[model samples]
Target: MLRFLIIAIGAPLFLMAMPAHGFARLTIDADSQYRYAQSRLDSGAVDEAVAEFNRFIHFFPADPRVPQARFQTGVAHFRAGRYQAAAAIFNQQTVGFAGSPLDNQAFFMLSRSHARQGMIEQAIVDLHNLEALSSSTDVIDQVRYELGWLHVDQGRWNAADQAFNRISPDNRDRFQVANLKQSLALSGAIPFKHPTTAGFLSIVPGGGQLYTSRYQDAATAFLINAGLIWAAWESFDNEQYALGSMISFVGFGFYAGNIYGAVSSAHKYNRDQINAYRERLNQHRQISLSLAPSPKGAALCLTISF
Candidate 1:
């Protein structure tokens, strides 16, 4: 009789475990979606890949894979050169899941997005945060290098120099070393006043790089500027630079280019300090909590009044 009773009681318990196997079905569904989407992505069927992922997100809203999908969506946007959209998505993820395992990865993507938009400071901040938060020292070192280079792009010599100096010798990335040398060279050129020319070049992208003695950057800016000026001169004269109008325009380009270099260098330096703080926050796992009993006012009640 006892054996019979045990079997009768166990029957429902065994039956109840059947639905628990549903996760396997869900796994198949998600896998199928991922594979289909990957194929679309590979074949350059961007719209199809996006639609498939969107469907998966709708079905598995609470799944851990949501972040990964969101990140992939953001990547697609980035690859498509939709940087503003990509930055928005990545930034949302970084803030939305602050302590999640995906946080570091999100920040890494954010840095890339900001860079694409030419928002160098914000990108540098994200890079520093990624360096601090991730477990890999190698990743941190690589970000440190990138952050330093972004600063160089904006013409911040002092900050760039300090950032380079702080790099761990063991993790010395050669690419970063070369950029640091470049930043240093530009920094050496920033302190003279050619205000009017500087102001003009500063307003134009890539002008500062040339002003601070970054030859490649200067050539790029100079050529573009010269072309524009030549076009304007050509509008009025057949002989471009031989004309007074063309000569003045040519002179202005050189002047603007030089001034832009100094200011850009200075701006980059200030951002490095902001980036360092962000890195520090990630390096340490910080929390503030008081040790007290679980119930509210437990500490007060336990203590007797004197």
Candidate 2:
């Protein structure tokens, strides 16, 4: 009876333990794979991390960790500067993991990828969609700030102002917004030479170049035109009609070219000044966004500096 009791109890225990061991082994394998992939990413082994993430997704589609894995795959692409690929991955996650906590982050990453690729319109559209879809104030504020900066890059001053205005005054980005507005205003106020006026002034040879403040060019133009005119007149007085005609034609061509060149020069001068001003403004008006820790796992944060 004692032997029978021991066998009976040990048999059931063995049966339960066998299945538990199998389940534990499976769990360990899955977790190990996930951690390995994470470590690859942390070590900047982007390709290896992406491949590992793909394998994990394929093997454990239903796992709760799958969404994070998918997101990390996109991040790996982003870190490698494969922006289009990153965008594709992030965009898919937005739909594939709908309602997941990583949804907003995926959207933001998609927008940033587009922006990095110089697809400003697409970036703006993505940001707008993020604003509409996310209820998080932090996400919305971050999107607005991004929109503002994009507008500033495109020289859409009014649009930038409007975008910034939408952000609450109490938000930390308000000071940055003010600085951006001031920079835009100052850039717009930079004086530029009027092309039409420069052309008018060119009626007197070299006048247009002078008006553009190119004194050396103006002097060169005046000297060349005066010499050519004098040469043509002297040729005509000496009864060298053919030579005179040739010289006169050349002088007239130079005179007309001078006028056109001055107009173009003035326009170019204005453009150069504007570009320089923009460069200076850019140095002082950079805004960036990144992920930050939050009570709910992660959130977007905007950084601005001069």
Give the top-scoring candidate (TM-score).
2
Runs of candidate 1 exceeding 4 Å displacement: 1-28, 96-101, 131-136, 173-306
lDDT of 2 by residue, 193-288 (tens): 999999999889999999999999999999999999999999999999999999999999999998998999898898788777767767755455
Q: Weakest 10 consecutive residues, lDDT, candidate 2?
A: 292-301
Clashes of each: 6, 0
**Model 2 TM-score?**
0.69
- TM-score quality measure for candidate 1: 0.48
In the range 1-306, model 1's lDDT, one tens digit per residue, is 999999999988888887885445535477677668657766777767677777778887876566667766776676677888888988888775444435655676688778878787788878877766666655566566656656655656567666766667775554345444553655444344343454466565456655544567666665676666666666567654456576666658665654555466545544554455434322322121112221122121111100
In model 2, what is the error at residue 295, expressed in angstroms? Answer: 14
Clashing pairs in 2: none
Point to the candidate with the largest lDDT.
Answer: 2
